[model samples]
Target: MSRPRLLLVYPATHKLGWVKRFQLPSLALKQVAAATPTDWEIVLVDEVHEDVPFDGNFDLVGITAMTHQAARAYEISDRFRSQGKTVVLGGIHPTVLPEEAGRHADAVVIGEAEPVWAGLLGDFLAGKLQPVYRAAIPDGGQLSIPWGRRDIFSGKQYLTTQTLQASRGCPYDCPFCITTNYFGKSFRYREPEDVLAELATFSGKLTVFLDDNILGDAARAKPILAGMRGMGLKWGGQANLRFAEDPEAVRLLADSGCIGIFVGIESMAGEHANHPKTGSRYSQAELIKRIRDTGVVVEASMIFGFDDHDEGVFERTVRFLEECKPSLPTFHILTPYPGTALFDQFDGEGRLLHKDWSRYDHGQVVFKPKLMTPEQLYQGWQQARWEAYRWPKIIDRVMQSPGKPVHLLYNLLRRGGISRPQ
Candidate 1:
């Protein structure tokens, strides 16, 4: 008379360094637990913190993966299936390449799992699970869905366990981004009251909003921020530079206890510098200053290996970071993930080096650069990290932020030799 047991896994890419280990809990896996039928017994495992139990007792196993984690995910699926357990694969990688994933999993849930999760579970219990279950784009009602289960990760050692999402999807379709293709081009937001109600449930001192762009829509973000003002918890999330142009929104963010933001300043040298979503009319230095002046830390994210970037990009990028003095300056090589326009273009031009899903991580060079060799691109990315995270530079960047304690702690972590490329 016992209910069926389900194992939910968030696969780890590899052993992370000290600083990278300070990651937020897997919001996607937790959300999947939220959507599962109440009658099922759920066990969540985030591989970043613990090892996967291949011999665990469970009737069904579910895993979520991105492009970088696909190889490990497939291996995990094979292991579970070898033990005569039913396995399900979901997330961007599987949703884009279902056939490849299906080669390993018994079923693949494509798109948002909320709409079809109940049905998928029902059919599974009925012994009639299908090979694929596709859910349509979610509407407003789906946006306000609650996390029915969080007890699975309640006591895990994470930098912060408080995570919430107020919205989904992005309207812009950047070539290197798969978000648009996966989540669609329309912004879907949960009601402000619903978001605040969820926030009120968290007892943590800090919260991390996992939205692709927390302020993608200014009107929707304002109310959410306003509601969070008196909550007395520090928060951070990703946002486009355009948020700076709206002074009111910037004020609301600070008033709402937003201590940090991750901004994608992808490329400062090319036509990308002029694109609407990421581009800014003001210089990078000015825009960063404007945001930082609001007592919020700016973690500037930049990408190299664009067609317009030459061999000198590494030093130039380091120089820009030094000049901008963001609280943290993170760099990445341009990775063309599957289902993205960049991937199609690279595949067509025969510029892709290999389809090794593991190396598709942004740290590795997966495609040939238009202006430099792959070696140069990889070296540039490493050199940028080396230069930016060096002790002197880290100290200088930390001094620039108004939130000195938090910035200093973050910089010290990077300097602790955690972020260096393996």
Candidate 2:
């Protein structure tokens, strides 16, 4: 009998050209590949780099996608299923709307796939494949997942293939976020030793932790940072700004070869300040400066189009970034993604423009703004983006950055993103 083969796909909306080299390979697919029994051969096709081998003789086809990739993903699924291959669809989009996805797949993994992947494959081999496999939402507890299979990404040119997740889930449930819905309401960490051991296998110094917040649980994060102190790995990851409040934690983070960190500022509106995550505007700037002072680049992100935001939001946000002077400022239009409170509220109010998932990406405005037109929100986003990347502003930021070249590279790359004219 021929050995079983699995083809995992990372669908892309469009070709990325040289930009694909800087992107990270899909960690979600890697984890799925890891959970596959050793008996099966796994092949991966990242649509951004190469075309999917639709005619490949594979026993099982697995495709993962985020909200914006849903259209392309569904198209790919339909094509594969038409060829008589058993298909599975899972990811943020499908996990939120499994019924819609079920219409296109032989099976849908509702949550983390590791819990049911083996069983699904078994059922398939036994010719008893089911339509749905839902894993329970992980709440408070340690998270144990197979170290994602890095070999599956072999021969692929990514910025760094040494990416892993040390933890999952977030404690905070922001109205605009779906994290709590899809990944429970608490931080579930892995053993520090396991994370360190995985790092030991990484050959190079370039590593990235694809966690919701690497420092969400400072207690759990410290141990991993301590172990990585001597690893000599220059890494970057996202974390809540609150982490810098503890001086010792910042020291440990700096010593752990963390070259940069991305933190969410969300919005500059006063309503946002009341939240513990944002705190007061005065202190948020202080915290960002504290992290940047440690020779670590801090990429502070801001989203426009909160209910409290008005026509002046774009200028006000640009002013705040001027004061904070973070190493970089990332501006986004607030996106009401499915499976979030924001989406529900928008839909109930009939504020959503349409159910076109492709335009739901943060780069585009997909809802009517409470205080401004959708076109205004989009134009403001574009204007603020150009304002932040202006020659003088970029120079000011790069001057304070520890790694000047890296800072400039990031600035250029972010600026290169094409913006549709108003």
Candidate 3:
């Protein structure tokens, strides 16, 4: 007469080292828990912070993975299957490469799990679980699902446990992005009032929006921002630079308790201009200033190792970061994830160095560079992070960006003093 137990896991992408210890709560696993029936006893495991309970008694085990975490996911899946527990794998990497994932998991859930989760669970309990369950892309209105089970993350230490998503998918499809492939090419937003209602349930003063692009659609974002104005919540999310061109949208974002934003500048020298969605009418400097003028911290994301980049890119990138003085900046080596256009292009050109999934983390270089050696590209990326997070540079950026000293300081302390890979 006991209820079936469901174990949900988020696999760690790398071995836990000093540098790899920073982890945010897994919103995906919590969302999966939300979809599970209340009759089941659900336990969530984030391998980043805690050990996976391989020997735990569970009727079913569900694991989610990204590209870098695929290896760890497979290991976890194999262990659970060995214990006679039915294992299911889902998320971007498994969804894109279902066949490979199926080799390990008893069942694979492709795409969003919301639509098919109940059916899948019913079939499993009936002792007739299918090999694959594909969920149809739901409409924007369907995104107004229940909030994630935040209680699962209760005792864990995290930078921010309050993560919410108002929308799914992105309008822009950059070659290096896997989001469009997984979420589709259109923006699907939950109703503003619904999103506001969910936000009201959180007790934390800070929240992190998990939207791929929070401002993907200005009209949809406006109401959400307006709703947040009186909520007394400080939040941050990723957005495109175009958000600055619309004066009203910028004002709404700032007034809506937006303490920080992550903007993908990608490259400083207009290298990404050929991509329609990345092309900006305003210069990077202008966009950063406009966002900062609203008293919102800007965490500019820049990628190195583009085909157009040369050895001098590191110095030029550091110079731009200093000049623009965004509250915080992140540098990453361009990674070609499995389902992206960049992956296809690199695979065809015989430029991919190896199929090692662990090295696919954005910080590592996995492909041959067009203009520089792979080592040079990786070192350049490390140099950018080194220079950007130095005490002097952090102090200068903090002074340039008006308010959100706490936001700036948190970023600085998190990134500062981390030794770069040789």
Candidate 4:
């Protein structure tokens, strides 16, 4: 008798250097694997960091992919099907477009995978698999924590390999963002005790919290921070800027081993989510200073090319970032990824220039900018990135940051020399 084998595949893509080297375990897959019966043998393949061998024998294949990698994911699904093996597709893109995905997969798991995963596997073994299975959203409950699969990432070199999840979903429905659409308008939190227990497994210096919005709920965050401080761990994750509103929450996070956080500033001029018809969340200057005062370093992310932007946008954006003085500033062109509200807008307006998924990365302009020519949009993006990362500005930002000087210096040296696209 042989044990059932499961192959978990992460799709291949052309991406940033940081994304390629450190292929961390997908917590979504980990949770699904944890729910499987003991008789199954599992193997993980992250094509971004490793070579995926088709020769390996497996009873079932599960692949998770985003919009950019949908083409490659479908290719893999087709290849496995040709080999007379079962393939299942689930993730953000698939969950939103299940009807299209079901055409490629023998079965598709939608929404949260935990509640529906076991049933899907069971049905497959019983030869009663359905075309689509939806996971029930746990009401007033957090996700069940899985045991550490630390061995899975042992060979990979990421900035920090330790990964954990404490929360999910975003309350704001920004047109360009897919998070709110996938997770719902209301935020869901993990139990503080559960989060602490999960954090205890990693002995590494850096703990990455894989959450859409880490500090979404103030009440839940207080206890979670208390527990993290007790553990003495240094962690990072994405969060909303509104966390600065409550002084107590800020203090708790600093005490709880939070060295840095990534906040989506969206745009320097507060002109995101289309036009004045759609609401803008916060003013740029207020949000940046409030987060910095908490003693927690910030990595601010801003998007370019909102409808309101024009020729003057680049210089204004750079000045806003310089004044904010975040430890690191990430600038990206506005991208209309498939399944998002923005994608529909681009499609309707016939602004999309190409369907090449590789360039859909925030770096490239996949569509024409309404206010500027395609050439202007490209040049503006490159100029903004190069200017923001210049030596003098980098030094000033590092010097003003709240973290250890050595850490800041290390980042400065790491970023000292990088080529810009010609």
Regions of model 3 farther than 4 Å from truth: 14-22, 137-142, 420-422
Model 1 TM-score? Answer: 0.94
Candidate 3 TM-score, C-alpha based: 0.94
lDDT of each: 0.84, 0.89, 0.84, 0.75
> Which model scores highest in lDDT?
2
What does the lDDT come to for candidate 2?
0.89
Q: 1-422 in candidate 1: lDDT tens per residue? A: 59899999999887665543477787888888989978899988888878898888898999999999999999999989988999999999999899999999999999988888999999998899999999775443336566546687865777787887888888787888988666778678888898888899876478899899999889988999999888897898999877888779889999998989999888763534434565456677887888888779898889898878899888888887788888888888999999988899999999999999999988789999999999988877887888788878877877767778888887776556535654
Residue 362 displacement in candidate 1 (angstroms): 1.0
- How displaced is residue 130 in candidate 2, in Å? 0.9
Report the lDDT tens digits of candidate 3 across residue range 1-422: 59999999998865565544355688888888888988998988888767999888889999999889999999999988888889999999888899999999999999988878888999999999999998765433436567888887877777767898988987567889988766777888888988998899876467999998899899999999998888889898999887888889999999999988998888874664555655567777887889898889888889898888999999999998888777788888899999889999999999999999978998789999899999999888887788778778777877766675775666666586558657
**What is the per-residue lDDT of model 2 for residues 184-241, given as tens digits with 9 covering 90 to 100?**
8999999999999999998755899999899999999999999999888989999999
- Residue pairs whose backbone atoms clash in candidate 4: none
Q: Which structure is stronger by lDDT: 1 or 2?
A: 2
Total clashing pairs in model 1: 0
The clash count for each model shown is 0, 0, 0, 0
Q: Candidate 4 — what's its lDDT? A: 0.75
For candidate 2, what is the TM-score? 0.97
Assess the local accuracy of residue 380 in candidate 1 as a C-alpha lDDT between 0 and 100: 74
